[model samples]
Target: MSLNFNKAEFTRSAAARSGFLRDGRPQFAFAGRSNVGKSSVINRLLGRKNLAYVGASPGKTTQINYFLVDQQAYLVDLPGYGYAKVSKAEKDRWGRLMESYFQDEGGLITTGVLIVDIRHKPTADDVTMHNWFRESGCPEIVVANKLDKLKRSQVEPALELIRQTLELREEDRLVPFSAEKGAGKEELIRLLCEACGQ
Candidate 1:
């Protein structure tokens, strides 16, 4: 089914598990490092400039922010991880929150989108996030964001590096995306629709 993404809007931000929405709509959780441009990717996908709160500083998203798309599925914006400036206590808090969300057997997440910088190799945090998605039994889609930073000739090699570093299955997807140029937006939306069973 085709998703009418034009109707997307900000839903709510949850700092704890108790605040998560229980309306039964499938959620595609977006996860990545603090500076991976995850929020920019979400904004680009929704065709809105600021709907997802692009942060000026790294690791600005301290909660799980939900955006309802066409009032059907939800686009869950998970807090950015791997920011070293945060205190150990804060990191532990974020870790527990993320673990609870991913470990839930009720299947709140319909899919997982792991965004990474297309210009660099995937970091250790990226690998851990990928594993969490796999352990949760949610279909994983790795998005190599910031595609505009690479030259045309460099795109293929960059994508290849991301594929190998993430150790993705042949069936898994690793899309080359550019939030600034809107490249791969349609493909990402199609995947999201497929994940949510629209």
Candidate 2:
């Protein structure tokens, strides 16, 4: 189950279901709010500064990105959710794209990696995304990003809030991660490796 995280490379982006790759490789799908530093966490994970586009503006990533890692697994980056400035039509398109991907029974998704801002409770859209992952019936991991923004005393309560808000099961893996400093990266990498084995 060993993986060379450093060997990661962006493969393609899918703007629709027809564009999704279904080559049977394990897909570790990462989903998060538009402004929750999703791209930053992904960049940190791959140890690449800008491999996964860190948009100058929130909601800029409107497509699903697939990155091949060590030529084995796919790091699937789902579109960011809950951007306030987008039009209703744009939001609906995002919703439909997400729904279609999740609803498909091809099992393209192997693991669901949901990232959230550690400083706040999960939003309604986050909960919806979490539930979609659960419904997909695959193993799920929640990464609490932006951990560096919080004080030491505020960490536990913030994590607890995320736990309760997402209603994470006991078996779920919740990682408190600081993308800026690489804290918790190993644990997350371990989980992704385990996902590859599964």
TM-score, per-candidate, Cα-based:
0.96, 0.97
Task: For residues 89-165, write the lDDT of model 1, one tens digit per residue.
Answer: 98888898889888775778898999999999999999999999998988999999999998999999998998898
What are the lDDT figures for the candidates, one per model? 0.89, 0.91
Candidate 2's residue-wise lDDT over 125-198, tens digit each?
89999999999998999999989999999999999999999888799999999999999999999999998886
Measured on C-alpha atoms, candidate 2 has an lDDT of: 0.91
The positional error of residue 95 in candidate 1, measured at the CA in angstroms, is 0.8
Question: Model 2: how large is the Cα RMSD against the reference?
Answer: 1.0
- How many clashes in each candidate? 0, 0
Reference-based TM-score, model 1: 0.96
